[model samples]
Target: MSSDLEPHGRIGVVRLGDALDWSTAPDVRTMVSTMWDDLAGGCLVLDLAATTFCDSTGLGTLVSICTDSGERGVRLIVAAPPPGVLRMLRITGLTAFFELYDSAEDALRSARAGR
Candidate 1:
């Protein structure tokens, strides 16, 4: 697993570099949630290009994060998810629940435009 933190313009980007499984899901959720209060505007760009797989826990955590962010008016954009993960999101009817992008650049651009 690997990861990186970066700023794509004004959006804080957290790229997960590992396959999201039961073992790492909680940590990922906690880390992102903690970062919520630290990022300016509470907006985030999640780069999931390296995320190969995810389970219900990962999806649930994402949903929880979305719910929390919505209450605080924070925008969370997920970009470049693998096919498996994307399929899961689609199956759960959550594709409409988030702003998804094909790349980190795209997500950043959209975030900037919305700002």
Candidate 2:
């Protein structure tokens, strides 16, 4: 957990740990979901630039998170993924499914504007 439940009004920013693999993916999901539910309308921005690697479990957890957000009538934004993480998302066709931002600031701005 790089950052705790850092809430900036309705938009929450969760800095995913340095590695998002099987060991950390579950916690990631829990943190984001917990924040989403707590925030109402569930606007979240996940900062992934510090993350060096993400495995299948991480990717799957992301999908699950996205689904949960949608079911709650919101979307999750992800920002600044490292090279390996970006490649995996592209290869898995998840890049199109997510709203990717160049920076956390940009993602948060968008989240706020959507309100």
Candidate 3:
């Protein structure tokens, strides 16, 4: 998997590519953790538009990130998740646990408005 970080004022957008599975989830977690200093009290948009697959490990990673973000006062938003990922989140009853948007722009706008 690949990830790119883009900062827009107080919002940090992380665009994830390829697949988010067991092998990549740890890296993703580390990447996000390392950016916490820059993202604290700001918003984080996980742009998963290019991510094609997400396994159980990926879902767990996402949940952990969301929980940690809350503790750090960072808002975690998921944008453009593929159908499979969305389905997995729903099946796991995490749809209500996360803030989701159709696109990164939408998520960014919403986060900005809330601020």
Ranking by lDDT: 3, 2, 1
Which parts of model 1 are misplaced by more than 4 Å?
1-10, 40-42
Query: Model 3, 87: alpha-carbon shift in Å?
Result: 0.5
For model 3, the run of ten residues with the poorest summed lDDT: 1-10
Q: Per-candidate TM vs. native?
A: 0.84, 0.87, 0.90
lDDT of 3 at 11: 70
**Compared with the true structure, what per-residue lDDT tens digits does model 1 show for residues 11-43?**
567788666767887787777766665564647
lDDT of 2 by residue, 24-87 (tens): 9878876776676666675767888788888889888888877887887666888888888888
Q: Candidate 3 on 1-115: residue-level lDDT in tens?
A: 4444445656777788788989989889988887788877888889999999898899999999999999999989999999999999999899998999999889878988874
Local distance difference test, each candidate: 0.76, 0.78, 0.86
Q: Which stretches of candidate 3 lie over 4 Å from their true place?
A: 1-8
Best candidate, lDDT: 3
Better candidate by lDDT, 1 or 3: 3
Candidate 2: residue 58 lDDT (0-100): 86
- The order by descending TM-score is 3, 2, 1
RMSD of candidates 1 onward, in order: 2.5, 2.0, 1.8
